[model samples]
Every structure is written in C-alpha cells, then in structure tokens.
Target: MNDEILVPLDLSDAIAMIDRQKEQIAALTTENERLRKEIKEIKEKIKLTNEYVDKYHGLGDRSLEDARKVEREIALSQSETQWLNR
Candidate 1:
C-alpha cells in the first residue's frame, strides 16, 4: 500500500501560483511569436541567398552546402514552432 500526504495550499498561495503560471505562459507565447517571425525573416534571407548563389555561382559546392545548412535550420525552427503550438 502506498500512502500519500496532501498538503493544503492557501488561497493566496494558489492565486500567486496561478499568476506566475500566467506570466510564464505569456512569456512563452511572446518567445514563440518572436521565434516564428525570426524564422520567417531567415527563410526569406535564405531564399534571396539561394537566388544569388544560383544566378552568380550556379550553386557551387560551397553554396550548396550552405543552402543545406539553412534548410536544416529552417526544419529545426519549424519543428520547434510546432512543438510550441502543441
């Protein structure tokens, strides 16, 4: 048999905890939005870079590698955003 002890929480303490949780949720929402915006900006930059590389260098090995790196970054950012949404 397992025994469990329940500790009583005061109303003020419960309210404080709720307030702290709200603050944390707000902070996380702000951070998530910021990250999403940053990811959009980065993706736009990557598109421009890809275009320039294609036009000027015809996607040389180094440029191709850089593009792959940007793609990975985008993938990771998207996954993070999805997780945040969940």
Candidate 2:
C-alpha cells in the first residue's frame, strides 16, 4: 500500500519561498564572486613566486627550498579555494 500526502501553499507561503530562494541565490553569488577574487589573488601569488624562484635559481641563490615550500603552500591554497568554489 502507498500513501501520499499533498500540502497546498497559499500566496503568502509561495511569496516567502521565493524570497528565501532569492536570498540564497544572492548569498551564493556573493560567495562565488569572493571565491573568484581569492583565486585570482592566489594566481598572482603563484606567478610572483615562480618569478622569484626563477630569478633566484638563475643567480644560484640558497633560499630555493624555502621558496619551493612557499610555492607548494600557495598551490595548496589555490586547490582548496577551487574546491570550495565547486
């Protein structure tokens, strides 16, 4: 045996539901924009780090390991941010 219950929503309830959905969309949009900005910033950091690494490597600098560590951290942060956006 199967039983189903159907509930009807009035005008006010429908309006409220729509309003809630709108608020959720707005919040999500804001979050998406923020994540995009964060990703952009991370990319910039990566570019700068790579440039610094390249410059130092050319000069046979000793802080290469530290720069690599920083690069890895930045990459990890970027991956996390991308996962969050998804």
Candidate 3:
C-alpha cells in the first residue's frame, strides 16, 4: 500500500481559512450573547425562589412558636383543674 504525502497549503488557502475562522467567531459571539441572557434569566429565577423559601421558613417559625405557647397554656389549665379537684 502506497502512503500519500502531506502537501503544504499556499498563502491564499491560509487566508481563506482565516476568513472562515472569522465567520465562525462572529457566529459564536452571537450565540454567546444568547446564552448570557438565558443565564441571567435563570439567576433571577433562583433569586426569587430563595426569597420565597425565606418567607416560607419565617412563617413556619412563627407557627411553631404559637403552638408551643398554646401547649404551655393547656398544661397550666390542667394543673389548675387537678388542684381544684383535690
């Protein structure tokens, strides 16, 4: 089997290659801008979700505190009833 020798590219061919690379760079730049906008939108969504989570946890803490206060009151009332019975 005969092996093919590699030929050197001429100057015009190299310039044409550079022009193609420039076109690809322009296309990639446009794509990059689009991706950046998408990333910014995702970040905003994440921020809103974090704010909602914070609000939900804050309400849960208040609910838990109120429940504990009610439990204490019920215990006090039971103790008073027992004393009256005795």
Candidate 4:
C-alpha cells in the first residue's frame, strides 16, 4: 500500500485583502462627509451675498434722487447769481 500526504492551505493572504478593502471604505466615507460640509457652507455664503445685493439696490435709488435734488439747487443758485451781476 502507498501513503499520500495533503498540505493545509494558508489564509493570511485572504485576511490582508479584506483589511485593504476596509481601509478603502473608511477613506471614501471621510471624503463624502467633507464634501457635504463644503456644499452647505457654499450655499450659506451665496444666500448672504444675495441679501447684501438686494439691500444695496434700494440704497442706489435713494442716492440717485438725492443727486438730482442737489443738481437743481446748484442750477438755481447760478441763475440768481447771473441776474444779480447784471
């Protein structure tokens, strides 16, 4: 009768592959959270900028009316001065 021997398989390589996959998943999760925070901050900044622009639009109309009033007063003063000189 002849005898045969069987060798046992090693599982270290499989365990290393699983560890690498876990590391990749962790990295992806961290990157996703960072992107979400950045998006939120950008949206808030846009909202603030829009509000500032709207406020300035109202101020611009008031400034234009004031400038027109000043110009009329200057013109009337110049006309009176010329009449007095004559």
| Clashing residue pair totals per candidate (backbone < 3 A) | 0, 0, 0, 0
Candidate scoring better on lDDT of 3 and 4:
3
Tens digits of lDDT, candidate 1, 1-86: 12222234455678889999999999999999988887887778678767856764665787777777767876787678678766
**Total residue pair clashes for candidate 1:** 0
Best-first order by lDDT: 2, 1, 3, 4
Model 1 CA RMSD to the hidden true structure, in angstroms: 9.6
RMSD of every prediction: 9.6, 7.2, 21.9, 22.8
Where does the lowest 10-residue lDDT sum fall in candidate 4?
1-10
- TM-score per prediction, in order, is 0.55, 0.62, 0.54, 0.50
Instruction: Tell me the lDDT of model 4 at 8.
Output: 19
Model 2, residue 5: C-alpha shift (Å): 19
Clashing pairs in 3: none
Better model by TM-score: candidate 2 vs candidate 3:
2
Q: Model 2 over residues 6-80: C-alpha lDDT tens digits?
A: 233455678899999999999999999997888789779978897878777754546677697887888797799
Compose the digit string of candidate 3's lDDT tens values, residues 1-86. 12222223455678889999999999999989976875675566556545655555557877566555655665676577558646
Minimal lDDT window, size 10, model 2: 1-10
Better of 2 and 3 by lDDT: 2
lDDT of each: 0.75, 0.79, 0.66, 0.63
